[model samples]
Target: MRQWTTGRERAWRLLLIAALAAPAVCFADGDAVTAKAKTSLNIVVGSREARPGKEVSVPVTLQTNGLKPAVLKMTIRFNPAYVSYVEEEDGAAAVGADKVVTAFELPSGSLNVVVAGFNDNAMNDGLLFNVVFYVSNAAPQGTIVPLTCPSGDGVLSAADPLAARLDVTATAGSIEIICKGPPAPNPVAGWFDAQEGAGLTWGESAGAEAYQIYRSEMNDPATAEAVTDWLPSTARQYVDASILANLQDYCRLYYWVRARNAEECASDPGGPVDFVINEIPDAPSGLTATRGHSDGVLLMWNGVPNGAEYRVYRSNNNDPATRQPVSEWMPATFSFMDTTTPAAQYGIAAGCSGRLLLDFFQYTYWVAARHTNGCESDLSEPAQGFRGLPESEAAGVLPERGDLTAWASICVLLMLAHRAWKTRKA
Candidate 1:
């Protein structure tokens, strides 16, 4: 299961506030769905602390467990008296939404924060998004503003949002009105980079001296280790260039960062965002190369399930690099007819000076498949083709018409002279 977390990073909050505060996210009013949902998701909201009149960003994280939902809408309830829903981003887009696609504040002090995205099969890794709140200045200290992720429909205490039809278990979160905390770096957003591996980017933390990155095979921080030395406070991103060394197709990678002071570290760490690499096509199978009519060679190979194209390679004299592809990147073909086999180079080297040479020539060949992603499969087993011997010589690639004519003419003159000599002797 992959879990994404959120936090109160000043950089994201400032940008988010600026984007939505000027013009609050607005969407057409719609009815809320309280339908019992069935999904494989577990949503968790982490707790945060802020002083009265201060703002806080609570991470809204979830475990996908590899189930990419077609759509998700999470409706939340918050206390307006204790804290106000600050600038919200409309999330018709998906997780990582700064503002929801639509927002509804009920007269009963409940808020419907609907966040939704469509992904029927594919999935990416990272924190879903964060919920921001502005604590009322008049609110008393030590008050906890609950950001409750309540269940909708049925006796099911919690379920996926209406129409989502996914089984969802949500754990609610809150913010305590207190003034004791160190400024920490914001949660990171990560994505896969084909060239360099997983890429991580975070916002500048408040009063941070420097930053350091950590990585782990699992999502747990306890299993993580710092992969980089202290980076300058101005550094906001890092790329896991070493990931390709251990990466497998479609494998997942995890990373996170933390803020530091001159003599201390933040009380808490930022998020451990994850990313999934892409998958390459499998190697082709069941390759066969046999002698075609005369000296031509026929090649056949089984198609790969994900293969987009196939390549052919031939070698004479057993050198793998000798033969170039008679045809390259052939699409939708399982076989090729190599009429130019007994390559001219090999033929010439095998004493092909006479019109009909009883020379022996051998050719070896291999085949491979290519994926749409430009990844090539391993070459198939070598198949050999022969150009000499009794069977192959008769059908051997013919030489020029004039190659043996001069020799034939000389033979006729010698025969005439021998006959005349015999007559004279008689």
Candidate 2:
């Protein structure tokens, strides 16, 4: 029984040795079959964040170890959900496995490979590949990309370390306009109150290089005029003092602005504003007056066109007294009657009564013309008049009464005597 047991044990050991030696022999017959694969893959993504309509590039590397002149065929796959083929080059050709492969070339150093593609759809999706190529503008913010490599030969059991995850973000391009001061009023009749220069402001944008400004009159809509030259800096405010004119009876004015890049243009027209002008009235002119009768004075003056009325002033001592309205402003008649006692009491002084009656009297009057628009003329030159005393009582002489031949003779004698004396004194 012990001998039989020993034979069975010998058979078991031989079978174990054969099983181990069989693999070694088989490996020696063909190319040495290493326990692990000699192939390695690495992926690198460029510009994880991208703008719309832009291209992205990815680099891929494959290395072979162990034997010289070893042949390596690498297949790279991209998730169709996330990437689109823009262009491909090298021995790398598209195969049925949703992949591209570079055919065997003797492993020359470490193979440095690169591939690039784009994202055409306006959506975000996960990308899985040894390398990923896509633009991010169409993709949503914060997209993660994973790289993977399938195990190849038993000689290369482990894939290259997974590349760092690539995160994608999207950027946008835009433009805007800004206005500085209040807009000019529409239908501008009188004058523009705008400062020297005023217009809209432009905000920052990605592609815009300059801006254009437009203006039009409210009355004449067909006459749309463009301001000269592009606004140089990003600042979009434009000074348009040149566009305004005097007495332009405009109903409303409109403005429009636009942004431009080398290739594209965007426009924004702000709301319109309405305006009108206010003018001051002209001063009144041609004021004059004339005098009239006993215990009453009639005043008259030339009429001013559009004159509302006239103001009259009277003074007995040449000083300007209170002024009274001759008529309502711009009145049809430019005449007035002065019925005051001072104006009516016009008389000569009586001489040789109990005492010489002194009638020292002078009067002065002024007139001003007013326009309907509230403009007043300068005062007219004063009109003057005077009253004198009678001469009968002067020279301390009296008329003598003569009757019949004798009285007549006496009166003639006295008159002759008085005349002779006055003439001698003169």
lDDT of each: 0.58, 0.37
Q: Which stretches in model 1 have alpha-carbon errors above 4 Å? A: 1-39, 89-100, 118-125, 154-163, 166-172, 181-426
With candidate 2 superimposed using the best TM-score fit, by how many Å does residue 206's alpha carbon deviate from the native? 53
Alpha-carbon deviation at 222 in model 2, angstroms:
53
Each model's Cα RMSD: 24.3, 36.8
Model 2 residue runs over 4 Å out of place are 1-292, 317-330, 343-357, 385-426
Which lDDT tens digits does candidate 1 get at residues 1-426? 223223544344334433432222211111223332223344445577766766787654434434343344566666788777765532222444232245566665565545555333322223445667788777765787666655453221223342333322343346677744346567688778677777888888777888888888667887889888988988998887877775654344567788876544342568879764644456677777653234466678889877889988887756765768868699868998777655322122122232333243557888888777666666777887643222344343443222233433455566678779999999
Best by lDDT: 1
Question: What value of lDDT does candidate 2 attain over all alpha carbons?
Answer: 0.37
What's the C-alpha lDDT at position 258 in model 2? Answer: 50
